[model samples]
Target: MNNPEEKEITFVMPFGPQHPASGHFNAMITCAGENVVDLKAYPGYLHRGFEKLMEYRTHVQNTMLSDRVCILDPFSNEMAYVHAAEISSGVEAPERAKYIRAIMAELGRILSHLTWIGIMSSALGLESGAKIAWGDREKIIRLNEVITGGRLYPCYFMPGGVRDDITGDMAGEISRVLDTLEDKGKLYDDFVFFNTTFTTRTNGIGVINAEDAVALGATGPTLRATGMGSDVRKDEPYDAYPCVDLEIVTMEKGDAYSRSMVRRGEIAASISLIRQLLQKMPAGDFKVKWPMTKKVPPGETYFCCEAARGELCFHMVSDGTDKPYRVKIRGPSFSLALAVFPYLSRGVQIADIPAIYWSLDPCPADMDR
Candidate 1:
C-alpha cells in the first residue's frame, strides 16, 4: 500500500493473442488505473512470410498464395496480383470478363463486411446483431458456391479472367439474393445501427481527424470516416469500375460510429453496382486464353484494387520466366492497426480499446505477409 500523498502508478496490460475480442495480435497498453496512457501493437503471430514464398513459385501458383494470404477478403487479393501479372505479360481479359470480375469483387466486399458486422457486433455484446449479420452473410456465401463451385477462397479469379462465367438464370438468382440482403440491411439498421447503446458507445470513442488519419497511413473506411472522399475504385478505376457507377462514401466525424456507418453504406452501394454490372455486361469471350505456364516479359508493374478493407495493392517483377522475380503486397490493415496507438492516449478508458481496434478492421494476416 502506498501513502495518500504518493503519485499514481502506471502499469502495462497485454490485450493479446488469446484475447476474447481481437484474434491473434497483442496490444501492450500502459494504464493508470482505468485510463490508458500509451499503447503499442505487437503483430506477427500469423506471419507466414508469404511474399518470399511467391518468388519461388510459378506465376499461376502465386495466385493461390495471394488469395489465401488475406483470409478475410477474397477477389480483391486475387484481382490485384493478377492485374499486375497481366500488365507485365501484356495480357487483358475480355470486356464481359471485366464486368463479371467487378460483380464478383463487390460481392466479396458485401460478404466481408457482413462478417465484420457480426464480429464487431458480438464484441459490443450485440448477440442478436451477430446472429442476424452472420445468418445473412451465409446467403452471400451460398451465392459464391453457385458461381465458383466453392464457398470461401473461391479460387475463381484467374490471371486473364474468371475461371467461369455466370449463366442467365444464375444471374437472376444472385439478384434475388441481393434483394434479401437489402431487407436484412434494414433489419440491421433497426436492431444495431440506430441502437442507443451502440451509438453512445461508439460515437466519440477513437476519433481521428482527417490529417492525423492520412499521416498515420490509415485507409479504407477508416480514412473515409475522416471525410477524405478517396476510394481507389472511384479515383483509379480498374476492371469494370470505369464502366460502372458507384459512390466514394465518407463521413465527417471520423469517429468509430462514422467508420461503422461508412462500411454500412458501402454494402448498399456494392449491391447496386453488382446489379448494373450484371445488366450491362457485354457478351464476349470470357478470357484471352493464355497458357498458365507461359513466361511473362521482363518488366515490373503495380496494381491496386479497392478491396473490402481498402486499397489492396500488388507489385510484381518478371524476368521472362514462368516464375516471378519478386512480389510485394501492401495491405491497409498493417498501417491502420498501428494507427490505433495514437487514439489510446491518456484519459481513454481501457474498455474503448477493442471497439477502436475493430473500427479499423485490422487483419493481421495482411501484415504478416
Candidate 2:
C-alpha cells in the first residue's frame, strides 16, 4: 500500500526539559533504529545571571550568591570567590581557618558524591540504591547544619577565613560522621559498584580517551578517568592543601565505570583529608575581622579550587569599591554537560543514554550559571 514516490525520514527525539534522566536539561537525539547517530546538548534551562548579579552586590554579600552557583557543592564556589577576593584585597586567612576551609571543602566533596550516587542509581533504575545513598547523605547534611549552620549552602567561608571556629563538639561530630561514612563505603561497593547489573551497564560504555577528553574540555573525574592524574589540589595547592598529604585518583579505561571509580576513590581520599585536617588543625582565630563596608583594592585576580565536579575558578576585578566590577565563574559542568555529553552520546544505544549522562555528573545549574 506504499506509494512508489514516497520518501522516508529519520526520527529525531527530544530527550528532556522535564525528563528524570535529563535532570532539567535537554538533548536533541537522532536515532537510527535505537542507536544514536547524533546528539546536541541544550543547556540554560536554569539561568540566574550570577556573574552580572555579583557585580551589583558587595564582595561579602556575593558569598551568599556564590552558594547558589552549584547547590551540590556550594562550598567550592564560596572558596573560589573568597579566594579571588582575598587575593585582590591582599588578605590571608589564619592557619586554623585554612585548615577549616580544607575540611569543609572535603566534606562538600563527599556530600556531592553522595548526591550523585543516589541520583545516578535512580537513573539506572536502582531505586533501592538511590534510597540508601540519599538516606546516608542526610547524615552529612545534619552534620553540616550543626557545624556551619546551613544544611546545603554553608555560606561559612569568607574572603579571609571561615565564619566561625570548629569547636570541640563540632570536631567530635565531624569525626563521628566520617567514621560512619567510611563504614558505609563497603556497602556502596557491594550495592552499586560491585553489583553485576551496574557493571554490565557501565563497564565499557561511553568511552573517552585522555587526549579526547582534554580536547573536549573535560575536567574532574571525566578527565581523570582517562589515566590523567591532573588535579587542581595536587598541581596548585591552595588553602591548607599544601600542608596536607593528598593524592589524585585516576583510572585507565576512561569509560563510565572508570569515571565512577575515580569518584569512588575520591570519596575515600576526602575522608582521609578530613582526618588529617582534624589532627593537624591549629588553634587560632577563625577569621579576620572586617567591616561590612569593606572595599577591595582595584586589582584583577584569579583563584581556583578542586570542586566536586572539577576546577572551579573565579576571575574577579575590583574598582576600589565594596562591589566587584566584574566577576566570571568557570564551572566545569558547562563543558562536561554541553560539550562532552554530546560527544559521548554518538553511537550509544538509547538504553545507555542515562548511564552515560549521569556518569559525567553534569549539574545543569552549574552549566547555566
Candidate 3:
C-alpha cells in the first residue's frame, strides 16, 4: 500500500478472444479501479486475408470467397464483389435482376441487424431479447434458402446478375415473413428497448457527437446516431436504391441507445424498401448468363454498396484474364473496431464497455479481412 497522496495504480486487463460478451475480438483495457482509461483492439483471430485470396481465385470463385468476409452478411459481400467484377467486364445487370438484388440485399440487412440484436442483447444479459430476435432472424435465413438454395452462404449473386430469379410464390413467402417480423418488432420495443434497465445502462453512455464521429470515420447507424444522416445508399445510389424511396433514419443522441434506435428504425425502412422493390419488379431475364471461366477486360474498377454495417467497397484490377491482378476490400468495421471503439471507451466504466462496444456493431470477420 502507498500513501493516499500518491497516484492511483492502473491495471491492464485482456477482455476478449474467449469472453462470451467480447464477440471473439480482444481488447486490452487499461483501467484505474472500475474506470477505463484507455483500450486498444486486438483483431485477427478470424483473419483469412480475403483480399489476397481473391487475387488467386477466379472471378467466379471469388464470389464464394467473399462470403467468408462476413458470414453474418454474406449477401452484401457477394454483391459488392460481383459489382466490381461486372464493372471491370463492362457487363450490366438486367433491370429485373437489379430489383431482385435490391430485394435480397434489404432482406439481408434485416437478417444481419436481427443477429446484431441477438448478440448485443445477450451481451447485456437480456436472454429473452436474444431469443426473440434470433427466432425472427431464422425466418429471413429460410427465405434465403428458398430463393438461393443455400442458407448462410447463398452465393447467389454473380457478376452480371443473380444465379436465379425470384418466383411468384417466393415473393408471397417473403411478404409473409416480412409481416411476421413487423408484428414482432413491438415485442423488441417492450422487452428490450423500453426496459428501464436497458435505458439506464445505455442512455448518455459512450457519447460521440456528429463532428467527432465523421472525423473518426464512423458510418452507417453509428454515424447516423449522431444526426449526420450520411449513408452510402443516399450519398451514392446503387442497384435498385436509385429507383426506390428510402428514408435515412437518424437520431440526435450519439450514445448506445441512439445507435440501437437508428438500427431499429432502419429495420422498418428496409422492410418498406423490399415491399416497394417487389412491387416494381419487371418481367425479363434475370441474368446475362456468362461462363464461370469468363475473362474480364484489362481495367480497374472500384465498386461499393451499403452493407448492413456501413459502406462495403471492393477494388478490382484485371489484366484481361479470369483471375484478378489485385483486389482490395474496405470494410466499415475496421474503423469502428480499431479506431472508434478505443476513442469512445476512455473514461467509461468497465461494465459499460460491452454497451459501447456492441453499439457500433463491429464484426470481427469484417475487421480482420
Candidate 4:
C-alpha cells in the first residue's frame, strides 16, 4: 500500500548536549528516506583549551590539566605526561615506582572499558546489561579511591614516581575487588553475549575491513577487531610491563559486535594483570628525590602510551624552563572520530548511527582538546 504521488522529505536531526546518551557533545544527522546522508559532530560546547593552556603552566601544574583530557581514562594521561617528562629529563623511575604505575594504568583500563560497555548497552536499549556494567564499575572506582585518595582524577603520578605508596591493605583490597568483578563478569557475559536480541542488533553492523581500519588510523580495540595485533603495551614495553606477562586480544570481524567483544576480553586481561602485579610487587621508595627547583633540561621528547582508547602520544619541547616551549597531545579519539563520520553516514538508517557512534567510543573532549 504505497502512494505513487507521495515524496519523502529529507530532514536533519540534532542529537546531543542534553540527550539521554550523547555523552558530552552534540551530533547532527541528515536523513533522506530513512537513511542518513550526512553526519556532523560538534564538540566545542565544553572546550577548555587544554593544549594552549598547558603552554602557560609549569610542568607539574600541567599534570592536573592532563586528567581533564579524557575524563574516563584520566590515569593514562597522567602516566603519559609524567613519562614524557621523565624521558625528556633522563630520569628513570625506580623498580617499585614502575610496578605501581603499571597497576594504576591497568586499573584505569578496566574502569574505562567498563564505562564504555555500560554506555553502549544503554544506547542499544539493553537496560539490564547497562546496570550490571556500571554497578561493577563502582567497585573499580572504590579501588582507585583507596590507592590515590581520588576516584575520577587521581593525579597520583608525579615526574619521577608515584604520589603515595600502595600498602598491604590497599593491595589486599584490590585483590578482593578483582575477585568480585570476576564473578560478576561471568553473569554479564551470559546476559549480553548470549542474548539473541543483543546479537541481532550489533552483529555484522558498522563493519570495517582490516585495510580500511588501518588506512583510517584506527587503534586499540577498533584496530584489534580487524585482526591487527598492535598494542603499545605489547609492541613497546614501558614501565613494569616488561616485568609481567601480557597478551593481545584480537577479533577477525571488524563490526560493532566484534569491537564490544574485544573490549570485554581486554577487561578480563586487565584484571589478570592487576592480580599478578599485586602478588609480585616489590618494596622500595615510592617517590624519587628530585631537586626542589623542578627544572627539565632543554630538549624535545616524544612519548606514547597504550591508552584505553588507543595510542596517546605526547610531543614536548622544553627550553630549560619550568613551563614547556611547545606541547602537543595526540589523542587517539580524534582519529577515531574522523574515521567514523565518513563510514557511518552512507547506506545506514538514522537509528543505526548511535550504535556506530558508540562503537567508536568517541570522547568529544579528547577530540576537541
Model 1, residue 70: displacement in angstroms?
Answer: 1.2
lDDT of 4 by residue, 1-369 (tens): 699888888998887766465777777778897988887777676678888898888877888889889988998899889899888888988888888999999999999998887888888888888898899889989888889999999988888898899986888888898899888877878777667767888788889988888887888888899899999998888998987888788999999899888988998899899888877888988878755347889999889999999999899999998788888998888878766555655678777777887888877778777
* Total clashing pairs for each candidate: 0, 0, 0, 0
Task: Count backbone clashes in candidate 1.
Answer: 0
- Mind giving the per-residue lDDT tens digits that candidate 1 earns over 282-357? 9988877768787999989988888888878998888999888989899888788766444534468988887787
lDDT of 2: 0.91
Candidate 1 residue 171 C-alpha distance from true site, Å: 0.6
- What pairs collide in candidate 3? none
Best by lDDT: 2
TM-score of each: 0.96, 0.97, 0.97, 0.97
Give the residue spans of candidate 1 off by over 4 A: 1-7, 341-347
Across residues 1-369, which tens digit of lDDT does each residue of candidate 2 receive?
879896554679888888586777999999887889999988878899999999999988999999999999988999999899899989899999999999999999999999999988898888878998999889999988998999998999987899988986899999899999999888999899888888899999999999999998899999999999989999989999998889789999999999999999999999999999999999989999766669888989888898999989999989999999999999999999999999999999988999999999989889998
Candidate 1 accuracy as TM-score = 0.96
Candidate 3 ranges beyond 4 A from true positions: 1-7
- What shift in Å separates residue 343 of candidate 3 from its native position after superposition? 0.4
Give the lDDT ranking, best first.
Answer: 2, 3, 1, 4
